[model samples]
Target: DPPNAHIEVSDDGQGIADQRVDGRYGLAIMAERAERIRGRLEIRPRHPHGTTVAVVLGPAGRRDSV
Candidate 1:
């Protein structure tokens, strides 16, 4: 991974009504996945429409030789 990796997933549909409380299983799953990989998940509304899901991740961990 690079110094800072930004994974942005956006759609041109209806955006998230509220950022704090979302009762969607998909969103929950995404959050879990991000956390599991030591990343940050952010869900926000687009400038015009739809939703924007951004996942910010740090560089990958170093692996030691066996």
Candidate 2:
């Protein structure tokens, strides 16, 4: 069976300050995992707030037993 999963992360501390470009390692890791599992990751800014990161895991096709 195929299932859909959505993961969202949002914070309103400083709204992604303009002086921080050294904290994107996590995003890289997430992308790697997503690719390994045939998934995708999306990033966008939250309206009137901060940034939002969304990750979706697509279903893995059915496989027959060997």
Candidate 3:
């Protein structure tokens, strides 16, 4: 895998409310997926307005051939 990879998903229309940031199921799902893949997910406020979600997938370990 690459050293770093960023994925941004956002919308300007009615950005996520601060209260819902931690209550959203989607966000939780994202986190779970990241953990399953040995990666991490970060979420932060975007410039002006909106939320930014970034996911980084680290390199996979090499397996020894039998």
Candidate 4:
């Protein structure tokens, strides 16, 4: 839909350590941008490996899948 969008970034490396995200400049910028577009930001660890970052937009961020 034109009023909705998403963006996801993931990695297979060692993944983000706990404190690394707090003072990080790049991640902060990304989160800010998401908020500006009225989107939600999610940062979580992957199943067996790294980290996943997801941004969802639209009403309640509900979607079938992408």
TM-score against truth, every candidate: 0.68, 0.62, 0.61, 0.69
Worst 10 residues of 1 by lDDT: 57-66
Candidate that beats the other on lDDT, 3 or 4, i.e. the better one: 4
Off by over 4 Å in 1: 1-3, 19-23, 59-66
Query: Model 2: per-residue lDDT, tens digit, 1-66?
Result: 444667789876546554536756776787777666666778777878888888776676222221
Candidate 3: tens digits of C-alpha lDDT, residues 12-51: 5545666765455987888977777666788877778777
lDDT of 2: 0.67
- What TM-score quantifies how close candidate 3 is to the native fold? 0.61
Best by TM-score: 4
lDDT of every model, 2 decimals = 0.74, 0.67, 0.66, 0.76
For residue 24, model 1's alpha carbon misses the true position, in angstroms, by: 3.7
Q: Rank the candidates by TM-score, best first.
A: 4, 1, 2, 3
Off by over 4 Å in 3: 1-4, 20-23, 61-66
Q: Model 4: which residue pairs collide?
A: none
RMSD of 2: 5.9
**Weakest 10 consecutive residues, lDDT, candidate 3?**
57-66
